[model samples]
Target: MNYVLYAVPFFFLLIGLELLADRWRKVSTYRLADAINSLSAGVLSTTVGLLTKVVGLLTYTFAWQHWGVFELSAQNLWVWLFAFVFYDFCYYWNHRLGHERNVLWAAHSVHHQSEEYNLSTALRQTSTGWIFGWVFYLPMALVGVPPLVFLTVAALNLLYQFWVHTRHIPKLGWFEWVFISPSNHRVHHAQNAVYMDRNYGGVFIVWDRLFGTFQEELDEEPVVFGVTTPLASWNPLWANLQFYVVLWRDAVLAESWWDKLRIWFMRTGWRPADVAAKYPQSKADLSQFVKFHVPLRPAQQLYAGLQFVLYVAAGSFLLATGANQSVAVLLGSCAWMAFGLYVLGLWLENRPQALGLEVLRLLLNAPALWLAEQAGLLPISTLGWSLLGLYSLASALALVLVARRGSAALPA
Candidate 1:
């Protein structure tokens, strides 16, 4: 069962509720561009996962069938109970090492790039985590947990975590000590030195407390969300690749072969001595920290928002049917989605070339729609094609008007 896909509507519904709470409290917990960027990363992750998730699933299934020490039955009630707790135990380590190790951090850092704590932030996830993250759960496979049980429990663990990303919820006194609560999970997202790399549990906070990585949300030191080194762009692609690029650059510059190779597995921020001296990167001072923003004019925001809704609708379709798609078809769909998202990011950043890129994207819609139909990915009728052409033409006109309004708002 595709559990995450089924939960999509509920996710947005809760986010809407959180937005209402923010209004009632007179607090601004979401910025439109940031929320969009976070959602873009999530959408990208889910799209990418369609192609990548097989790596972990295949490995776990192979291990369970060939070499599992016990024959755990999925039909047993105790097995479900045991696997539910065990999955989180494995997730605790997978998450902890994601923060502690360099190469792992490169993939996991996308989630922390968001500067705001809101329900949307819960959807922000890493695209490349399947590379090494699967190894953490091998113990469960070895102990004979069936693939179906593992998958279900893992999904449940993830679903349970969604609500904890909001700032509207206060600390639940005893709940904070046992299960992962909104308050303690907020600390998990904090970059403040005291809170950094703490609270690695998924469903239960007991693992964190037992493992000595727990840190309570403190009133004295209010949490500052985001990483020490901020991802200053709205680009979802860049958000995923930013740290990997940094690591690669450092590795290439290192004088010693050993440093070049070891840097990937070393502690999260460890750099080669030669690279550090020549090109130093300083962490942002928390006291002087500012959230990254590129203010969009109201017209620009409306255009971007409207365009994003179209992409979301398309993405939902892809998610629902992706498992049945051929690799070639899936790749083609993902490429177009990635391009659309990149252009959207440019618009969010208010780049000067945004108008041109968006115009290009609008123009590409005809060919893309035709190609998708050819591939049987979209069953568009003659009327659907006409509607698409009309959409493209209208979008181009809107883009030009938005550009003019933005230019008029700027100083001479």
Candidate 2:
């Protein structure tokens, strides 16, 4: 069973409740664009995972079948318990190394790009983590944890980490010592000098306490969320690729062949001496930090939000049905979703060409839906097609009205 898929509605419900809590506390933690961008990255991650997950599953299955010393039964309660703890143990190192190494951090940085600490920020995940993430859990497979048990515990471990992303939760007295709480996790997300690479556990705080990476949230030094190199754009695609792009450029520019190869696996933030001298990178001052933002009119914000709702609906359908789809269908669906999201990011940035791209997207959607139906990838009734038509028309009309009202002026 796909627990993450089933938990989708509940996640949104908690996000809504968090919003209410923010209101009650008289604090503003959710920004429309930032929240939407965070969720968009999440949706993209899940959508891309649908296509890439086979790599991890197949690798795990191969390892277990080939090298298992014991055949663990899922029915055993103790097996489940052990797997849960062991998964967190593996996750601690995976997460710690992700922050410590340059290439690993390239894929992991998406989660920290959000300046706001909220439920939505929790969903900001990497689409490319599968490239190296599977290696972390091989110990579980070697120890003969059943695949089903391993998957269930992995999902539960992830779900447990979601609630810790909020700012509303205060530090628990004793619980903070053993388990990850919002306060400690906030330190993990902070860019402050004291908090930069600390608190790398997912569910258990003991890992950090034992490994010497733990840092307490200090009253004198409040946590400032986001990376040292601010992701200045709201683009979800760019968010995932920004660090990789930086590394790629550095690798290309490095004069020494050894530095070119080592630049990727070297310590996080390490640059070749030659590249550093030629193309200096500036670090933000933690004491005087400012968030990256692009101004948008109210109408533009509303339009972007409404369009995101439709994307969510489409993404939910894909997640629920993707397992049963053929490779072609899954890839096609992912590509379409990714394009739509990229276009949405452009719209949020108020790009001059966004309106034209949106029109193209709407026009292309009719054929895309029709093709999916014909390919038997999606079930489309007459009403479904009618609704699609109506939605496209409505969105186009909204774009026109927003543009004519001079609210969505193209960025100069």
Candidate 3:
């Protein structure tokens, strides 16, 4: 039923409402570059999922068809009730192992990279989780839960998680004891020594409590967000690849074959003794932690924001119609969207070459739009093309004016 797809507008609406709350409360919880980068990772993840989701879906369905122990009917209310709770039990392990193991953490770390914990941070998902995440949910399939029920509960579980990513909600006393709440989930996102690797349940905190992974949010120790190893850039592609690259290099540097082979499957931060001794990695000083930032003028910020809106609109269109698209057209559109996001990341970083790269992006709009129309990905009318042309021209002119303002202006 594409429940997550249908919830997209509401997700953004809540994010907007959160911004208003931030204003009224006189507390800032979002940074423009960080929020955009988080959203970029999310957009990339969903777009990539359109291609990779068959892995998880097919494997689960296969397991259900061949190894069913009980015949569960979707029409039964008990089946829905049981599947909802059971899925969260499975998710607890899927999420817990994702933090406890190396290869899994490499994929799950994208969600934790955002220092500012907000609704946008919830959207910062991994594109590569399909590599091994399907194995965790086979128990539900084996127990004969219908695939339709499994899908619905999974969406509901995820949808239930969205509101818990905010700071506005305080501890809900008794409710905090059983179900996942903002307070406990905030502890889950914290990287402090006390908070690390705790509270992994998706909908029910009961699983964490039963499994001994629960940690209450303490008033004495304020939560410090983000991971120990900070993602020091705004690049979405790099955010997904960061930990994997670290693990690969460590594996290559190890002298022992066993260490090299086992490093990937080992605990989250386990490194070979030889590699650790020879090339020591410095621990982050939590007291000195600073969020990643880059300077931009007001005009430049506005330009970046407007261009991002265009990409969001295009990406939304692709997701809604991707099933009917030819493989070539889908792949082409995905590639273009990724390339555009990478360039936007550079703009956010305020790279010296950002101006030139943006100019190149603006110039490419004409041929890119024409190619998309020819591929039947976009059935744009003359008016649509004209509007897009005007957008590109205005963007190019905006870029020129911003560059002319020089680097001496105050930062955004």
Candidate 4:
């Protein structure tokens, strides 16, 4: 039923509320570029999922049709109840292994790249998780859980996790004992020595407690957010690929064929001895850890924010109608969206060439829009085209003015 689609407005509404709470408490829980980067990663993930989701669905459907032990009916109440619990049980392992292995961590690390713990952080997800994530849920298919029931329960499990990625919520007494609460989840995100690799649960805390991976959030050791190795850029594409690039480089440098192959599946931080000796990687000292930031003028910030709003509007439209689109239209839209985001990342970093790239993007947008309309993928009247042309011209003019004024940098 596309529950995630229906929940989009509420997600932004809650993010707004969290911002209000931060203002009231005089606690800055969100940085403009960081939050935007987080949201960009999420948008990219969703767009990519549209193309890759079929891989998981096909495997699950095949398993269910060919190897079912019982004919599970979604109409049955017990099926719903059991599926909810079972899905989370599977999710617990999926999430745990995501942190414990190198290749899996390469995909999952995008979520931990955010230095701040806010509602926006929850939306930060991976585009590459579909590579192995489907393997964890095969038990559900084998047990005869229908595809509809599995999807519904999986969505519910994800929706339940959204509110837990916050710093304002305090630990609830008995509620912390059973369900996955905000406090425990915060520990799961921490890279502190005591908190690393702990509390790997989705909706229920029972899995972690039973599996001996639970760690209580301690007042003595205040939680420090983010991964041990910082993703020091605001680029969403880079966030998803940084660890993978690192691993690939290490694999290339390794002398032995076995070392080259095994390095990808080894423990999360394991590195080949020869590679490690030649190219040392520095881990952040938590005591003096600093969050990544890039300076931007107020006008640039406003411009980036406005451009992001436009991207979100475009992304929402794509999500709503993308499935019905022709392959050419869908791929074209996805490419345009990705290019806009890549340029946004460049702009946020204050690269001198950002305006040029953005100019190029705007110049291309007109033809892209016209082509979509010509192909019947989009229905735009003359007035609509005129408005878009005007927007492009206006944005170019604004970029020129912002560039001439000499970008004034303010500390983030």
Candidate 5:
């Protein structure tokens, strides 16, 4: 089943409901725009993922075909299932290590950069996760999981994660111990000392429970979200690049080359003494103002929740459909989607210039999509029509959004 395409609408529907529920219960603590921006990153990233998968598939088929793993995978579904489960187990380590190591943290920090925690946070994924990120999944290949099942299970695992990002859910009794609940996951997103680098789990919290990385949410000191060095700006590209840029600057600033080299691989919080001394550590307590600024009204809360569900449903559909799609087509579509939404979200949040750019992109994409269909870049199917319609609607909404701002400042 092309589960992802269906998941996209499902995601929007649920997110909309979640938003409305927040308004009713008054539990939300994030802005609608920020949440939407985060989700836009998510939609863009999921679309970007199509390219990575295409590259991965080609490398697996033509290049790695002679390997023993493919042979083993050809015969055994059980092997595929085991590999799928084991891969997630390994993911827990990769995730845990991402928080613990500075180099990995630089890449992983994109997901955590969102100050707001909501369904969109699940969508606030990293575009460059293919770097070193693929390494964690290799064990599945080694153990003979066919590329197809590996991707399907991987997508399913990711799809499972969508609902976990919400703040509307409380701790789920014993489920909290065995699963990644909103409360526990919120602690993982926290930059607070007690919560930092803890609760590394994907579908199952059992890994965190067994690994000693798990930390229960504290009522005494509420979870203060975001990184120690807060990303104050709203630019998506800046969010992605900030840690790398910081790492490079610190490398240059270090008096000794060893300190420069040492810092990037060290624990995430580690900084050279001089850097620490000059910059000082930031421990902004978000708890005080969180209640005042973030909670949503019942209707708006549901609307946001529904919006998220819709993006996920759309993203997942494309992801699953593109899994088997030709590499060239997948890559081309992703190039448009990732860069488009990434910039659009930025325009919506930080800069107005991108609004014009997004307009150009929207204009170009419609004809490009039609041409792609004519050129057989994509199959003309019901699913394709649905995607085209939704994307068109989304793009139109994006343009209207520019006008809605009432900035009246055209591109300079």
Candidate 6:
């Protein structure tokens, strides 16, 4: 059975609940277009997943060969439970390490790039974590957990996390102790000092409770979400890479080699003394911060909301149909990508002009789909891996153009 096929309906359920909550309780968790854009990114990520799995399989099979052991089955329930919990335990460590180590942090930070916390934020997953992510769960197989069980449980764990992304639910008293509740999960998303590096549970919240890394959501200071070194831009790729790129620049600019070595392994945001001394505190005064203007025009909202429904329906179809090779698959992909870029433009408008470069990026990726076709990259494979290096390079240059336009507009 194609488990991911259900993500379409789940996407709709999330959006509908968000809307219903907004009307009934005035707790509007997402703007329509932003939601669509987020959903589109998720669709694109799954499109990317088809490629990543090939890498995952090769790595897993190679490990098994090196150990001279291979066992596969769908008949074991106890092993599934074991792998399920075991993966969460490993994930807790991987996730916790992601917040602590700068290199790991770089790969994981993209998920926290969104300032407006909502269901959309949940869909904002990292694309690069696959590189080291699988290594963390290898112990499950060594313990003899079936591969099918591992895959299924991981999916279930992910599905369980989806509902926690919303702000609609208030704190559940005792439920907060055993399962990852909205309150505890909200604290995990926060950028505040108290909330930082806490709550690393996946399926069960008990892991956090036992690990001494748990932090409660207090009513005093409301959580200010997103990474401390904020991306503050709309380009999803840039969001994924900004921290690592910054860390790299700092490491290269360091006078001593030890400083370079210390940067990646130390706690994230840790800087060398010399490097910190040269360029000191240039903090923006938050009181002077102007709120981003969504404007929320009635017509604009309607347009965005409508686009959200239409593009999601279209993307969902693409996801379900075409079991790897089919003609005209780009139809759903283009509509979805366009929606992503369009909503990104909406949020980008409120940010610094420097952030709008994402528009060019959105424009740049369209050709990869075409190029994939012309090059006969997959023969009959229409859309499994349409956008690759070409698409990314084009998007980067497109963003550069948007940045250039903005720079030119400023008066000397």
Reference-based lDDT, each prediction: 0.92, 0.93, 0.90, 0.91, 0.71, 0.66
Candidate 2 pairs with clashing backbones: none
User: Candidate 6 lDDT, tens digit per residue, 1-412?
Assistant: 4566786577567767787878898665665544544564565566555446556656655555455244645576665666778889988998998888888898888777666677777887776778778888776666555556767787888877877887778899989888898888999988777788899898778888898999999998677766667665555546556887989988998998998988988888888888889866464443344323354334334433543454455446555644463344454454445545455544433455424444543454456455545644334253444534554565466555545664676699
Please identify model 4 stretches exceeding 4 Å from their true place.
407-412
TM-score of 2: 0.98
How far is each candidate from the true structure, as Cα RMSD in Å? 1.1, 1.6, 1.9, 2.1, 5.6, 7.3
In candidate 4, position 95 carries an lDDT of 98
TM-score of every prediction relative to native: 0.98, 0.98, 0.97, 0.97, 0.76, 0.76
Segments of candidate 6 deviating more than 4 angstroms: 32-37, 65-73, 281-412
Off by over 4 Å in 2: 407-412
Query: lDDT at 392 for candidate 6?
Result: 54
Off by over 4 Å in 3: 407-412
Ranking 1 against 4 by TM-score, winner? 1
lDDT of 1 by residue, 1-412 (tens): 9899899999999999998999999999999999999999999999988899999999999999999999999889999999999999999999999999999999999999899999999999988998999999999999999999999999999999999999888999988888999999999999999999999999999999998999999999999999987899999999999999999999999999999999999999999999999999888889988999997778889899899988888888889999998898888888988999999999999888877888888888889988888888889998998888788888888877887887788799
Candidate 3 per-residue C-alpha lDDT over 342-381 given as tens digits, one digit per residue, 9 for 90 to 100: 8999998888887788888888888888898898878889
Q: 44-149 in candidate 2: lDDT tens per residue?
A: 9998999999999999998999998899999999999999999999999999999999999999999999999999999999999999999999999999998999
Residues 1-412, candidate 4, lDDT per residue (tens digit)? 7877778899999999999999999999999899999999888888777777889999999999999899999889999999999999999999999999999999999999898999999999998999999999999999999999999999999999999999999999999889999999999999899999999899999999999999999999999999988988888889999999999999999999999999999999999999999999887789998888898888889889988988777777777777677777767777887888889999999887888898898898899888889878789998998899889888888888788765433234
Model 1: residues with Cα > 4 Å off, grouped in runs: none
Q: Candidate 5 — what's its lDDT?
A: 0.71
In every candidate, how many clashes are there?
Answer: 0, 0, 0, 0, 25, 0
Q: Candidate 4 at residue 155, lDDT?
A: 92
Deviation in Å, model 5, residue 134 alpha carbon: 1.7
